[model samples]
Target chain A: MRPVFLIVLALISQASLADSPPLERQQALLELLHQDCGSCHGMTLQGGLGPALLPSALEGKSALMLTATILQGRPGTAMPPWSSLLTQQEAEWLVTQLKQPAPPQDANRH
Target chain B: MRNQNLNNFRYFLVCLMATVFLVSLPRAPLADVRGTGDLGLVVERTSGSLTAINSTTRRAVGKITGLGDLSHASLVYSPDERYAFVFGRDGALTKVDVLENKIVKRVEQAHNSVGGAISQDGRLIATSNYDPGGVRVFSADTLEKVADIKAEYGDGQLAKVVGLVDAPGQKFVFSLFEAGEIWTADLHDPKNPKIQKFKAGKEPYDALISPEGRYYIAGLFGEDGLALLDLWNSDAGIRKIVPEYAKNDPKLPVFKMPHLEGRALVGDYWFLPAVGHHEMLVIDRREWKVVRRIPLDGQPVFVIPRPDERQIWVNFALPDNDKLQVIDTRDLSVVQRLTPGKAVLHMEFTPKGQEVWVSARDDDQVLVYDTETFREMARIPAEKPSGIFFTARAHRLGL
Candidate 1:
C-alpha cells in the first residue's frame, strides 16, 4: 500500500515538474534533501545516529558510491534506501550538493 | 527544676548547630520558590544557556550563561535539587545553583564530552568523554578531580564512553560506544574504585535504567536490537533483546537516534522507540518479549511515559518534528496528535504527571500542556530549547 502510494506520488511529482518552473522544483528538492535526508544524515551533515555526510567526511568516497548508497541504502545498517521516494537523477543531484561545502551555520544554533 | 533547665539548654544547642549549617551553605534569594524544587531547566542549545522555569507558575525564573557549545549537553541535579551539573559538548562540566541561577563552579574536564552522571551519594560527578575516550570522576562539592578510569577494550585502545549514569550503591554505569562494552565503576570508594565489565551490543549509542534501577537497556545504533543488562544480577551478563528485529522488518530510515533518557514504564510493560520505524515497541518487563507495537506518525525520539504511567507523551525527529502524540496506556492507541510547531525536541511531565512541557526548538518556545486534556496551557519563549529537565529528576534513580 505504501509503496504504491509512493509510486503515484512520484509520477505526479514528475509530471508536475514539466509544468512547474524549474527553480521551484529545484527548491522543493533542496528542501526535501535538506530537511528529509538531513534527519538521518545530520542537520549540518556532520553526523548523528548515522555517519557524517560532510564533504570532508565524504572526501574519498566516489560520487557513484554515494549515489548508490542514497538510492539503495547499505543493508545491515540504519541507512534506508531513498529509491522509492527519490528519482535516480535527484539522488545524483543530491550527491553533488553534499560534495560541496556545508551551508553557513548561524552563531546561535548549537 | 534543675533537670528541666538542662533539657532546655540541650534544645537551644541543637538550634544553634542548625543555624551554623545554614549559614555555611551558599544562600539564594529564590531557593524556596515552590516549597520543593519542582522547577524545570530548559537547555537553550544555540544560546549555550539554561532557562530556569517555575513549573507551577509557567514563567521563566532566570537564565544562566557562559557554558560552551551545548549541542549535545545533558544535565543532572544534586540530590537536594538545589544545584544542577551541566555537561557541555565541549567537555566542560559546570555546577550551577538552580535557585541562585548562576554557575558556582566550572571546569574543562576533557577535550570533548558527551555527558555525565552524578553518583548516587551525590558526592561524585563522572563524565563520559569523547576525546580521551575514558570516564573522569570529580568532587561534586568543589569540582576537583578525584579519579580517572580509562575505557580501554581490545588491543589497549581507549573507547569513547556513552550512557554514563549512577546506579545504586554509589556505582557509575556506562557503555563504551566504540568498544561495545558496558562497565560499572564502584564509586563507593571514589579515590580507589572497583570496576565490573560486561559485553554489550555493537555501538550501544545510549542507555537508560529502569525507574527502580533494575534494567540497563542500551539502544544499539550500529546494529539492530538492544543490549539488556540485569543490574540486579551482573553475573548473568548482558542479553540481547529483540535480536535482529530490524532484519526481518521493512527498511525504515531511523530519522534520529532515539534518546533512552526517559523510561517507558507503563504498567508492567516497557515501551521503546522502534529503530528506523514509525512505531513504539511494547515489551513485557517480565519476559522482555514484544507484546504489541503502537504505530506512530513518525520516528519517536523520546518515549516518555508520564509519572503515573497513565499515558506516554512522545516527540518526533524532523520533518515530523513539529508533531506530538499522546498514547492512551489502557488501549495503547494514540489519543492526540498535537501540532505544537517546528522541531519538538523534548518533553517533561510535572512530578505528579499533571502537566507536560515540551520544547519546540525551531519555534523558540516551550509549550506547556495539561496531561488530562492535552491542551496547550502556556507558551514560553526560549532559544533553541532541546531538553526539558525538572527538579523532580533528583529523586529518580537513573535520570
Candidate 2:
C-alpha cells in the first residue's frame, strides 16, 4: 500500500512540475508589474499614465523586439528603461504577458 | 438526356437573372461614407495615435492607434464617406471608419509614405515614400498594395515631397521640396503609371493646381516667391518659371525657414506663404508675376481660402504677436486676429466654415474658434497635434 501511494504521489508531482516553469514566471512578473508599475500602466495595462501595450497598440512588433524595448526604453519618449529596475529575464517575461491578447472585459462590454 | 437538358435550362435561366439584376441596378459606390455632422480629426504625432472628435460637443468619439511614428498624419475622406485614410510619419497608412472611429486596417509596408493624394473618384491613393525613393499605391478597399512608382530625390535635391495632389482622371502630382520638381504620374493603370517631370522653384513645399487642373503653383521656400508651372502645356514640353516675388523687400526682415509652408490656388492666382517678406505672395498664373504681396507677420504655415472666397484663414507656428491672421482676400489686408497662441501649426475649418480648427503645438490642444464671433469655443487636448482633416463627408465619397 505504501509503495502504491508513493507511485501515485510521484505521478501527480511530475504533472504539476511540468506546468510550473512558465506559469510561475508569468504570475510573478504580473504581480511585480501590478504592484510596482500599475500606478502608471493601469491594472490591466490598457495604458493611462503610460502608453497602451495591448495588441492593438503594439501590432507590428514581435515579442523579442518588445522585450528589448522593455529592457531599453525608447529614447526621446516618456518611456524609461527597466534594465536597472528588473532583471533581463524578468523583463522578457513581462513583455511576453504584454504581447498576449487582452482578456475580454465583462463589465465594460456595454 | 431529357433530365440533363432541363438542368442546363435552369442554369441558363439563373445566369440570365443574375445578369439582369447586375445590369438593371445602378452601379454600387466605391467606398463607404462615414459622417454628416462636424467630424473632428487630430493626429497625435508622438504616440502614433489619431482621434476623431465630434466638433459640436468637443468629444472624442472615435480613436485610431498603432500608427507608427506618425509625425504628420493627413486624413482623407472617401467620396462615399465610409472610411478615412490616414497617412502617417515614415509612410505608415491606416484606414479608419470615421462613423465608428475604429481602425479598419493598416498598411505597414509604406514606411515613408507620409502625405499623399487620393483620386477624386476615390479609386487610387498615391504616396511618395522617402527611403526607397518611390511612390506606393494602395487599393482603397482592402488596403492592399496596387502599384509603386520610382521617384527618388537626386543629389542636388534639397526639398522632400511636401504634399501630393491628384489631378483629373488618374494623374498624381508630387511637390518636391528643394528639388524644385513636380513629378506627375498617370494612375489609370496603377501597375504602370506613366511618369512625367516638370521643374518649378528653388524649394517648392506645397503645390496646388487650378480647380480645372490647368496650372500648377508651388511656394519657393526662403526665396520670397511662388513658382507657376503650366500643366496644360506639359505635352508641349514647355516649362516656364514665374519668379515674380523672388526678390526680397529691404523693409521686411527675412524669416528664413528650411521649407515653404503651404500654397492655395484661387481662380488663376496662386497664394503662397512668403516666409522672408512677411506676406502672402500672390502670383498671377497668366502673367507669371507677383501681382500683389499681401502683408503678413511672423511665419505662415497654412493659408486656406474660405469657400465664400471673401476671407482666408492663415495659421502660423511662430509665437509672434499674431498667430491666427484672417486676411481679406478682396483687399489682402489683415482683417482680424483670431487667437494669440504659440506655434499654431495647422488649421482646419468646419464644413459650413463656421469654426476654425487650430492645432497649437505649444499648448498640445486643438482650439475651436467660431469664425463669425471669433471666440474660443473649446479646447481638445492632444499630444503634439500636427495635422487635422475633416471626415464629415468621407463616408458618402467612400474614401
Interface RMSD of 2: 16.2
What is the DockQ for all candidates, taken in turn? 0.20, 0.02
Candidate 2, chain B, TM-score (2 decimals): 0.79
Which segments of candidate 1 are over 4 A away from where they belong? A1-103, A107-110, B1-36, B222-224, B247-250
Please state the error at residue B191 of candidate 1 in Å: 1.7
Candidate 1, chain B, TM-score (2 decimals)? 0.90
lDDT of 2 by residue, B1-399 (tens): 999999999999999999999899988765444344567578876567787788777766666777766654576877766677787655667888777667889877553444766776687766755535567788888888888765655763333465577766567777665466777788877788888877665655455566666655565553645655566777654254554545344233322232332225567676766653466778676767778878776656577876566678776533352377898777778888866465466777776778878887546788888877788888888765667877653432211
lDDT of candidate 1 over B1-399, digit per residue (tens): 999999999999999999999999887855555444767789987678999999878999899999876766789998889889999867889999888889999999987678899988889999998778899999999999999999998999988888888888899899998899999998877899899999897888788988778788887766767898888999999999876445334546554667885478876788888777788888887877888888999888899888888888888865588899999898887888898888788888888989999998768999999999887899999987888899888878877
TM-score of each: 0.80, 0.65
- Residue pairs clashing, model 1: none
lDDT of candidate model 1 versus the reference: 0.80
